[model samples]
Target: MSRARLSPALVVGAAISVVFVASALLSLVWTPYDVAAFDIGHRLEGPTAAHWLGRDHFGRDVASMILLGAGNALAVSLVAVLLGAGLGVPLGLLAAARRGLIDELVMRASDVAFAFPALILAILLTAVLGPGAINAVVAIGIFNVPVFARLTRGAALSLWTRDYVLAARMTGKGAARISLEHILPGLASVLIVQATLQFSLGVIAEAGLSYVGLGAQPPAASWGKMLADAQTLVSVAPLQAIFPGLAIVVTVLGLNLLGDGLRDRFDPRLDEER
Candidate 1:
């Protein structure tokens, strides 16, 4: 596709993703302020030369915490998406290839999983696993499994009957080999787009879980946790809530935009135009 023909949303989303990735990488090296350090005397201070994004209730620098929170959120969401895709794709391929009892069992189980909303699932898991980043990853990862499995199965089924797959079967290739070599490559574009969409959903799920005290615990800066902490001070410190909320909003928007653009790019009819 020609670069000039790319949608504006694609450009913006790519820029946003790059910005967040850079901020997260920088947080690994250093933050402008010690995110955990408390200076009660500086509490709720507006943005100033001293602190680019001001300070929170505990007088922690908002910019530094925001940067750290981006890293935490991205880590959980990315890992969750990877876990989901890893587990889901194989199950989906198995179901598609077997197409009998195995398919029925897997698809039915996915249906049962889909019944529970991500937030509810997070809360339930949190009760058993305890609140923390790991729990958040597990909760979101589980919620994502059904989505990926269903999407993969639906797409794989269409390709299963294609001429190439039939030829592979005629050549005595095993189901596993055909799936890995022939099937997976065909599903790459759709899966890539799905991954982007799922990453956004994972972020939203993690943030919601944290907001309700079921996610990343205190002392660990999380965007959702930051918003939760800022709630009580909304009247006096609206920036606390506003900044984190904007972070979530922008990140999700960017992922969605990128996913949409990818969908268009992978479609043969649309690709022709570019």
Candidate 2:
């Protein structure tokens, strides 16, 4: 299907996405100082001297923690997104293609998953799996699967009824071949939109889990964990919470705007408006 070029919203979203991606990548190579490095002399110091964002209660550099924390947040989001998309997309495709017992089973399972919110799932998983980064990933990923599965299935269902799909069937294209060759291409725009939406959700979920202490542990520096650590200090050291909270808000906002722009740019219905 034909589509219009990117709009202003998309351009801004792209810039924001690039910034966060670069920040995460840079954190892998270097931060101004080691995120965990502490000096008692610098404890609770405001932004000045050697520390740009100042030091935490333990004298660890806040700016450094932010960099490393951004990296961790990105990492968790990526993994959770990948896991959800990988598992959910195939199920959606299969449900659309198979459309019988298999579809019934898959859809039912996805519905069951829908009963629990991502945060609730995270809390449950944390209880079962115990607090850590991996557990957070799994919890978020699990919640994502149902969302992607339902979205993909709906999109694929629409495609399955298309004339091209009927034509493919007339040519004796097998279900798998028709799905890959005819259906998937049509669904790409939908998947891209869904992915960005999910990415934003993943960020929120990660932060929520971390805020509750079920996310990345202390000293490892996740944005959520940073907020958790700084909650008590907010009345006195507001910067401790503000920076990490702003990071989460900005990142999620960028993803959401990007997702909306993508839907307007690529979807055939929206393209007709242009």
Return the top candidate by TM-score: 1
Tens digits of per-residue lDDT, candidate 1, 163-246, equal 999999999999999999999999999999999999988889888888888888888888999999999999988998999999
**Residues 176-246 of candidate 2: C-alpha lDDT, one tens digit per residue:** 99888988888888888988888888889888888888998876888888888888999989998888899
What's model 1's lDDT at 169?
97
Estimate candidate 2's RMSD in Å: 1.9
Off by over 4 Å in 2: 1-5
* Residue 167 CA displacement from its true place in model 2, Å: 1.7
For lDDT, the strongest prediction is 1
Query: What TM-score, computed on C-alpha atoms, does each candidate reach?
Result: 0.95, 0.95
